[model samples]
Target: MAWRNALTKSMQELRIHLCQTSPASAGVRDFVMANYAEIKKVDPRFPVSLRECAGAEAKLTARYDFGVEKTVSVQGASSAAVLTQLQELIQLGEKMPKSGE
Candidate 1:
């Protein structure tokens, strides 16, 4: 029972973290995509794909084609608004009981 309690807590925490992180991460991704034109000007061959940016937490990968250039990677979290909403949703979810009691 103790182990079960711990497991449940852990799971809940994970869900909350994911819920909180996902939107912010997504926003970051969207920003990058929206600004791809500006970004590409810096590196014509920059890969501007959301999948490339999506990772465990929040990561971005840019492949530049500037003759002898290499892949550039950047990682960052989402903005405050996204984080706030996510946290709110997670808290709401936590308050609700699972189906079937």
Candidate 2:
């Protein structure tokens, strides 16, 4: 329970930081986009967008790659689930193959 709360808090904080303004948002976007392929390799549907929102809030959007054109929220409960999986993978020293393999 404690770890769960911590994870939620972490995600919220990250989103907030990213959406603060300018350089931060740009850095976050670059990092996420560069690593997006690796992230998707983990779940094949990781939240792929980190965008600035109104009044210092950030939005994380996920697209349904399977023909559905609707956008989905990747924060809150969803972020916890996938991020946890990713952290686990990292701790276990898992490696995703390079693109074009």
Candidate 3:
């Protein structure tokens, strides 16, 4: 919810890919558990997707318009670190206009 305004603009989707039981995904898992609800609450129309697999890498993908996407590896990252990255992406969204804006 740090930059919730981004959700109403060019932030198309927020995808979190992580392994269900991998140690590297622990932080992401914890983050989803604690803050995912709040994130959706901030922007009810924003799309937040979670994908869990046995051996998937832990990553966060923020998709914007014009097929633009920003991805960051969250492998072994702390929940706070993930949140910081997301806030940065939101800030980026504010500056990156959508196609034909």
Candidate 4:
């Protein structure tokens, strides 16, 4: 896939923080169910961790090479909105120059 070429060379992991049972987390939960498989299919080796707290704010955190990290809040957004944000983030990461570039 073309997206594979754009994958950040330094991206290390992805962490999803959300409340297991909360209205604000509904969209993220839906997004996960709809896209999690596709995400891993994109890169099985990339670690994606899910941390559920009863009342935690929904957020997406991506850890990149050299400990660089990016995060975005997904609170109350619909699944499509969440997907859009994720795609935008990936595009942004791809545009960022790597070390020694």
Model 1 agreement with the true structure over 1-101: per-residue lDDT tens digits: 13222223212222111122455456555544454466446445433344432234553222211221122222344444433443444344445554435
Candidate 2 on 1-101: residue-level lDDT in tens? 23333222222112212444444245444545555565445445323344456444233332222322222222322334434543443322223332233
Q: Estimate, for each residue in 1-101, the C-alpha lDDT of model 3 and write its tens digit.
A: 43556555658899999999999999999989998788778788788999999999999899988778999899999898888888888778778877767
Q: Model 4, 15: alpha-carbon shift in Å?
A: 0.9
- Ranking by TM-score, best first? 3, 4, 2, 1
By summed lDDT, the worst window of 10 consecutive residues in model 1 runs over: 64-73
Candidate 3 collision pairs: none
Overall lDDT per candidate, in order of appearance: 0.36, 0.36, 0.84, 0.78
- Compute the lDDT for candidate 2: 0.36
Native-referenced Cα lDDT, model 3: 0.84
**What are the RMSD figures for all models against the true structure?**
18.8, 12.1, 1.7, 2.4
TM-score of each: 0.29, 0.31, 0.87, 0.83
Q: lDDT at 61 for candidate 2?
A: 30
- Highest-TM-score candidate: 3
Task: Give stretches of model 1 more than 4 Å off.
Answer: 1-21, 47-49, 52-56, 61-76, 79-101
Please give the lDDT score at residue 88 for candidate 2: 41
Question: Best candidate, lDDT-wise?
Answer: 3
